[model samples]
Target: MNDHDRTASEVAHSLSRRQALKVAGGSALAFAAGRVVPSGADAQTPPSQPADPMQIILPETGITLPTDEVTFRWVDSGDSKALFFRAYFDAFTQAHPNIKFDYLGLPWTEIAQVVPLGVRNGNAPDVFQVPQEIPIAEAVREGWVRPIDDLIPNFPAWQAGFPPVSFVEGVNVFNGRVYTFPRSTSRRAGIVNYFNRAYLEEAGYNPAETPLTWDTLRDAARKVTENGQGQYYGIILVGKQVGRWEQYVRNMGRLAGSSAGPDDIDYRTGEYVYTSDGYLAAIELLLALRDDGVVFPGSMSLNDPQARAQMPQGVAGMIFEGEFTLPIWVRDNPDFEFGVSPIPTPSASFTPMGYQNTGTNHQWLYAESKLPEVAAEIFTYLGSEAGQLAFVSITGGSDPSVFDSVNQRAPVDERMRTVYGIYEKYMRLCPDVRIKNPETSQVYLRLQRPTPSFGEIVQGIYTGQLEDPKQAMQDLQDRQDQALDEAIEAARRDGANVSRDDYVFPNWDPTTDYLESDYAELG
Candidate 1:
């Protein structure tokens, strides 16, 4: 059967209603064993009308829900996060008694493959979590997902409560339409320096006072490392992992005020600045750290998990991580103490630039779902202070909340509070290259494609395999530009409303902020 041709009834009926966990006739029940049907006489009687919604004091979500029986299917990623969602769903179910949830949980690896295929097969989850790497615009453009602006009647009013930057063009809204709501921003929303208190104290430095400049940081690292005399090391770098390397490079590059990192684009000119001076400076610093013997000896060979293992064992003095790292460390070693601070720069005079507002894990409603209204209600609830707070608390308040009310309820750990405070002030959305061209949008997704992998390039530099950072970066730039040009030309031939002119900016100045005026078009 053609997936697009399936009717709502066909889709709904096709699901294994026999096995679904159900709340039938306002009564909670486990997964139904098998479909139970009324006999001839019992089936003939008139069905009872649903209880008056006005009478049910559904916990105040601040939004009104229509009185209807709704069965919502929701798929999510990650086991820990899934537990959080289940708790939220339970709370939601208690409030909206008429609705039932058929929850499906899968890891991100499976989710990327399963969700879209499931949706096309007409076995779609009404509300599904979209991974950060997926091209949301492409999903919407291809008619795989729907806009929530019209589906949720109170969406506009509710969205207005969030930070205005949340709706920046190409960040959240695409082509003036809102499709997904960010469940939470990156836990490490800004550049945070996570350091071990014991190590700092052992080195005769104050843990509470983080180094503000890169020179001081390097000195501190050297002092703590003691020329690799003990098991203790200055830092952990997962040189083999692209994400870990990319993060450090981007945060450092920001201080130098240039476009860098995999996601960074010169908003002013729509140009790839992977080879910018700031990026080179970042690499040079890493190389310097390596030469100083401050980095863990096995860093070049280790992956993220292996590298992070050094933290809990007190073998590393400092690390760069997001807010979530604190909780994970706490869970592993409750007695261990640490401090959080901003990533150090070359000088205090340099502007702090690692401000990133890129939405990481977001939730999108399937356009083909039969119960969008119900999904919208659940979506709004999840984004609410009450819902976000539940997740923050479950995650140990390490992940900062998007709403002020939820942050107010954040755990009073000094480190968490300090990190959240910095996040509130400095977090920003990085310029997106994904929205720039046909090819760039799929850069993260199409790993098999011919573009250079930032991970391999960084690993080469770290292992002394790649001699010149500048030449390597320039080569990367040439290849990336070529890919973009080819994609643009192909798109134009296919009658796409895009041109090379959309990417050019004659008046762009790298020294100044790439404000909205710098761009000819956002694309």
Candidate 2:
């Protein structure tokens, strides 16, 4: 189905907003219901003197409280710019008055080093938030964290709401159990192409509306380019950084029915749809834009922030980015004329306009902590409806499920409305893609040397440094296998289970042919 041809009904059938809410019942509803105490009730009054954190009840899921007050220390990676940690702490404290939050805000770069050290020194917060890429499974296997299954019953609900893909499948799960719950879900979509309606009209074209397909984008770029010369180009893309390049590749991969997950492409089988006709077609189309001079000059050198800056200043016509970019655009240039829509799909089949896997950022509780019960209560409440609402309100803009009540109570920007609309109708959590064996994560990290070094591989692909795609993929597979092997060996030396066959990969192939596939159908 073409992007335009695919209806909200079609996407809804796979993963609807209502179903997402139901699957995320505890979290979604908790956020919606507000505080459990009666309105104007003094939750900390003499009689109520804030029951020991262990005494708090997770009423939403019927989970009992712990016997001790658990102090959850968390650090925010995306702080200052975003209030994610503060919102979570605020909602958590209000719901469970006894539990205290030792909140810390840190840059993303510092979290990797700080978290591990904190764990060694016994100073790690009982409950903390970590980025999806930080090898959490290894932490779990190392006894730094705890398995969450014994604490709550709504885990299944949390898992069902995610999409079936490699990254989600590979990074979130360890030993067939979930260790993290995502904070904000994200997907790679075509960048929001911002056009100066004023500029388009001056160039003899209607700027108010434009088709989302690649061809339309190119044609519009051509028209816009004729008017501006070197001062502006029809579009801007991040090509210099491997991370941005990988995003581009992944976005293109989505159009071809692939993602960064194992199920979509099956790296083990050496079958990648990336080199397939559909993917190649998407690449050719993108390259055509570059060749036609429709892309901004030195686009390869531009990072996301730099590219976004051009949009408000009218230095560029269109740029592709994620949904998060909308808020910044609104904050910086209130009067900029722009519209939002899904990326266009290929002519053959209607792939959803956006990528499927939403990023997973989760909070885990320590099983061995002195306050498991209290920690569980806080964990459950944070995942509850009231908690979700509090988070949404504090963050200002979050998924509709988190802020559904607030969405109804206040007027929201069109961009936010658009994001909620898309998520409600079409968003699917990418299947769990993290390492199942916590030890394997350690190996992956060791082999990669520095975590960000993986970008070099991506850069090689974008810059044509690696001429053989098959070899490049094979090398990655080897490195991953080696990493897994190293992790397993280390575990064995430590008398832990680390066998090569011990790792379990989730099955996320949507194209699998099955007689009983109806159960797997999105509807």
Candidate 3:
């Protein structure tokens, strides 16, 4: 079969089959030019400049248009920082006079609260970034979203342009149909160590050139804290933002040997490894520093924004945060000098793992959208090579594209380049259970998390609320194990052919990406 036929077959086998896509008049050449003739423009008028500033990759072709003027609302947690939204949206409107946007660019914290409210009130944006609070699976199961295969023109050709795991089953594909794409690279996950260059210099260390070992990091925090003399501390964490604790543990846990995906379960053994040596050590290090009073004193009360804001003001010397911190600091506080490095591990030599899954987080096309075709076109644009380049250029490379080619081609500043280098040299992809067994994703959606959660457990332990850290971790593992068994049973009740074995990957390695060919061992 041809490439187009093969891609269509792959999409059909993904989650579920959908109606064949419909295409209207626009052509590849039309999208390549990123311009619109404006339904009634005079043939005499010269075409406008390219919609994509970089004008590299072709946008979507053969998109159908509405006869009357229409406005669609859009919301994303990253929009303000992404900046490309304004330019791309305006350019899209310029091409189609009848199309307009009612855009809402809010902080992720707010999006978390707003999304559920909007969905319940039937006012959710036509297109929106999936909130962290709701699992994408739950949204799909409840009919909050629809598959994009029927909306994006040329169902097969458009998706062919992305990388392998860009549209994995169970993550973005439900029942052999596509949903959304996670365009950001996992190599630049937020579990990173960002520091104040001035403070590190004062402590007689340069982390940018040589990353810190676990022990050295603790010592550095102590030194910086001591030198501050109550003026500034060595490190600050978002204790109030409970998720930060879990984020740190999971990302750094691999170094110690958690070897599982972010869910804290090691797929090799099909067991939750929260109490594993690596994960425990990561937690202990933070507690040890907090006990030594090296961590910022006011950390317990600070949220993400508050904590991140203090780093540049010299409230503390360091923060365990993600790539988002880069562009904001540069734009808002130009004078503050900072640097980012991978989160330190127990030993100087260590490995970090990243996983891809639809159940993770993604932007979705709402089921309630009256203009599904138009909404799909917007995401289609963002997912394009040219659109990705424009994003990199406008966002200052703070968030690199999923496609390596785009990251390489787009112009970036020194710090963004440094981040890309760090992700490339250090991060490794772990086994994705969803790829092996899409039904396993059903178990995840049904699984119930234990009380206090991962982050709260960390806070309770450090604040002297939860007494035994090891036991607490063990209890969490046990609770999750029970929940997994129950969820599996529930999935089976719904006619899903899945079992606990689906989560295990005997042939998996902690140091390398789990390839499609590796699934052969399961048989």
Candidate 4:
């Protein structure tokens, strides 16, 4: 059978097959040099500038349009510190007086609560920043946002400017249409093991030849513990918040080979494997650290911020954190010198491991915009090299530069170098399980909602509340599988096109990460 027939047959046997989708919309006209071009058609040259400020070539279409009096309603998840947004808005407006922006910069927390309400009320901004925690699929399905392929000219070429990894499944793409533009690289690229350089030296260990294996890291921690003499801890952990615990589990588990997060999939089988050897080994590692008395006291009671503070304050030798932590340390504890390294992997794995998110917090233009051309202009500009640079300069390189040129053009601060190195060498992209059935994302979210979460399984073991780490993981695996099945079945009942095959990851080699061709074959 051909691919289409195969898909139909699979859907029939497994889940539901959707009917032909008729999107309610009119297509935009792409006019260039007095000729009409199909949307997403390739352009030979960059868009030519028009004599009138109001009349400029649309980058996506190579079409010239009058943009004067067009006001783009932009809502962003930024606070007062995000002066870069205001700067960009002023610069863009000054450059083009005919075009205007109605910009609202709100805290991320507020944006999360307000944007959804605005969207539901048909009063949402023309262009808005996508929420970090919420899945973008929900908004696309609800018709709150529209695909950019038709709106933006030469969409695929425009998207190619970004790194291949940025196109996360079920995030930037839905129903084979590109939805959002990646605004920034992940602030937390992977699990960063930040260590006090002085502490390592004082412990008679060479910082250059730091730990690369799990066993050696433990030995190094013991050395730091011996050097501390009851005054400090070798390693600090944050167990109070669910996210912190989850990071610990993921960081440690990656070292052993577990790719299963709250809703992550095993690329090899397309199933959740929370009880894999990697996860259980990670839990056991934490238990060993506790028994060895290397973990900081009050870890269970301490909040994330409190736990994070210990490393900078010299109370802990190392911290398992993210790229953003370096900036905090730079601003607050400038006198303290430190270095970043990846979480040590097992001897068997050999390669260092860190978690990576495929997509990022992005900016999307609402489908129901009054001034689409104006909104498209702002969207395209912000995603451009110049616009991204302005934001990157202000953010102090905590986020990896999306533009390739920005990295080369940098003054190259120590922090930026560290982030670059970590992302390039250590970070491993986390598998997205919701690629096939976007509706199933809720199953993973629900697992995090409960008090004693899958991440908290380690904490349970650490506190003596749970005895067998393997059993706890096994139980979670079963629960996750059930949740996955229920979600797929319910979504099929609701006319969503999904099946068990969506979860399958055929011909994926976990050891080598496989090649891009392997992924293409599965698709």
Best by lDDT: 3
Candidate 2 residues lying further than 4 Å off, grouped into runs, are 1-73, 77-81, 84-135, 142-178, 184-210, 222-226, 238-243, 257-310, 353-359, 364-380, 394-396, 400-411, 420-455, 463-474, 477-523
Q: Which residue ranges in model 3 land beyond 4 Å of their true spot?
A: 1-60, 66-70, 96-99, 357-361, 449-451
Q: Give lDDT tens digits, candidate 2, residues 101-207.
A: 66664433355567767777887767665533445555565677776656766666754533343133234555556555555444334244445676666655553
Worst 10 residues of 2 by lDDT: 16-25
lDDT of 3 at 152: 79
Ranking by lDDT: 3, 1, 4, 2
Off by over 4 Å in 4: 1-160, 163-169, 175-179, 185-189, 259-263, 298-310, 348-357, 363-378, 427-453, 456-468, 494-497, 520-523
Decide which is better by lDDT, 3 or 4.
3
Output the lDDT of residue 381, model 1: 54
Task: Please give the CA lDDT of all the candidate structures.
Answer: 0.59, 0.49, 0.70, 0.58
Q: Provide the global lDDT of candidate 4 against the true structure.
A: 0.58
lDDT, candidate 4, 1-523, per-residue tens: 1111222122122211111111111432121101112222324533332221111222343434455566767877442113344444544554467767666755444566778888878888988876544546657666888877676566677677776666654667666677776766652444577888888777765433554567776777888888899888788887665456666776567556665333445655777656777766777777878888888887777654466667877887877776645654554466878877766677735433423345455778787877666656556655666445544543445555666666555433575576677556654544445543465544332222223566567667778888877788777777767766776676677666666676666654444444456556665
User: What is the C-alpha lDDT profile of model 1 across 150-258, one tens digit per residue?
Assistant: 7665677778766545654444565567777666665354347778887777776663564547787788889889944778888877665555676677767766677
RMSD of each: 10.9, 10.9, 9.9, 14.0
The number of the candidate with the highest TM-score is 3
